[model samples]
Target: MLNKTIAIIGAGNMGTSLIRGILNAQLTSAKKIYASGTRMEKLEKLKTEFGVHITTNNKDAAKRVDIVVLCVKAAVIRKVLEEMHDVLHKDQFIISIAAGVTTESMEKIVGKNIPIVRSMPNIASTVGLGSTAISFGKYVHEKQHDIAIKIFEAVGDVVVVGEQHLDAVTGLSGSGPAYIYMVIEALIDGGVKMGLPRDISTKLAIQTVLGSAKLVKESNVHPAILRDQVTTPGGTTINAIHELESHGLRSMLIDAVATATIRSRELSELINK
Candidate 1:
């Protein structure tokens, strides 16, 4: 928890979620938060819901906060930084959730050796279960890193990783929730094919996924071992596993992560260029 004022430069889903998470966890009070966005309607809604200061001026948001979170899109990170660079100072810490925008790129735009943190947090952050991986800029100190961790912990778990691994993190956890959603949909459809009602199938599939993930987390067991436990010598689950393996399910997921990583690298290269 922190007492310092914080600014979120883009009041979109992630930014809104951070405000909610911070308030829910009592990391900071509502009045200490400032959110900015292009859409007045959305910003007004956020103000009504979270009771935080709202603005259309990014520089105003940056001017007084001890920390500034850049939740804008990667393509607009440079523009946002350039717009607020005059108001930004070294004493303030910067955290950017814009995918593929490195701290080095941000530092270049700011032209100051500011404490910048690059974080990749998945969409699950909206529900306060996000898995976030963070890397630091050249000037970040231990105190700054601890503050960053506490801020992210309000939403979900946090991990410190080398900058080199961030692209892979972007591909895996950053894009992983979508993959799991697709899998859940497929599971629901499979239940429907087997004659279960649509609504019933949906609930069952969702709970099954949720319970399984919780088990893995709480039991601290290897996933393969858990699968083996669920699979008897000749059980229905084993049959399903065979079908999935035969259809290259595992390989498909692997390829998906790899492809995403490659694209992340390409996007980062574009921004750096």
Candidate 2:
């Protein structure tokens, strides 16, 4: 849907995953995608693997692309922007994947009239299945929003959320994959304790977790109902569930989300300050 050249200013895990997705989706040709990093070795690795242009100059990357992706950590956003500020064109859209960095702060660096987008995407982008939320700044035109959506959607699902909710999205989805991984690991441990082989236990645990999520997606029924179907009264499932409740499983999950939300808010305040 687009022919505009794109440049990514970081070659880390998320950045590399985004590159893979963009190519797999055929959103742009390899020749049009550029990956940039300060490390020559990393840039060389991306160049060898993707056959795309790689560079160590952030300014050069910004100067040559229509859409510039800022994939660095939140703490590093200001530094990266300052380095590329002189070369950033007025027409370029700066799409930031840094958690907790707001569009308002980004605008201050790029000029309030320059287009900017702040987005949060989970790690699932590596496999072409991720959930992302984005907020647009004042200078982001309708066309720019469309382009931002296209770029994020190439990796996974994309939603445009109000700026106020970006932090909540970060807590809920950005950091959620790790929580899910913990649950999967605990389930595998349980299987292993039951005498199942470690590898088999882990495989079953992972697939079951994934399948359960797919069922929720494909079935219109409320999760509670689907859960109830498997949890017949006085059945083995209910017994296990009772044991979980005895150990405060549900409350622990709620506390986990709450803690993550509070921490995200703190980080946002720190960055904004």
Candidate 3:
């Protein structure tokens, strides 16, 4: 444990997720964790639920902390940084979870000398199953980078990526959850249409997605290899595969990811302006 005081600048869903993760990892004691936000009730809820320090002033949150997590939305990061800039020290580190917000942009708002770590983490972090991609700023230290990785890894898998790849991570994992969610909804609908009970269909669809993901991780084989293994010369799986292919399912899914990637890159340009 680093034993450093950490402050979270927003108490929203992602902020709460990190708080839960930090508490679960026991990375820092409750007294060392501080949270601030504009919503009084939300901060109260977090204070009561987790027993951490809570406030509404961003600078108050920034003062006396070794590291700060910028959980605010992408649009308002600059405003918040401006609010806290006077109180921010060069020695302190910052970790940001806002999508499409680059480290260089943050440094422009905060200070070029401050250590900043930019990350993209999905909503799954609430359940400790998220995937996070991180990139370093110009002034970040290796020790701070390790600490940021530990903070993210407490919730799920962590990837150290080049700054240029962050937007792709935002496209793939950041918006990817909604894509899988749509697939699950369609699966459940198909099961229900086939006369299965709604509850059972939902459960089956969820488990199928989970199990397939586990297989991809544990089998250590290419997905095509596994696909060939399941395709008997004249099998039911092949028939379904043929139907899906005929309907252009694979191409549509590929296009969806590509579209999301393009949008993520576009957002970067917008944020830069």
TM-score between model 1 and native = 0.98
Tell me the tens digit of each residue's lDDT in model 3 across 120-183: 9998999999999999999999899899999999899999999999877887898889999999
With candidate 2 superimposed using the best TM-score fit, by how many Å does residue 172's alpha carbon deviate from the native? Answer: 1.1
The C-alpha lDDT values of all candidates are 0.94, 0.89, 0.91
lDDT string for model 1 (17-96, tens) is 88999899998899999999999999999989989999999999999799999999998999999999998999999999
- Give the clash count for each candidate: 0, 0, 0
Global Cα lDDT for candidate 1 = 0.94
Where's the lowest-lDDT run of ten residues in candidate 3?
104-113
TM per prediction: 0.98, 0.97, 0.97
Tell me the spans in candidate 1 whose CA falls farther than 4 Å from its real position: none
RMSD versus native structure for model 1: 0.8
Which ten-residue region of model 2 has the weakest summed lDDT?
109-118
Candidate with better TM-score, 1 vs 3: 1
Q: Which whole-number lDDT from 0 to 100 does residue 200 have in model 3?
A: 100
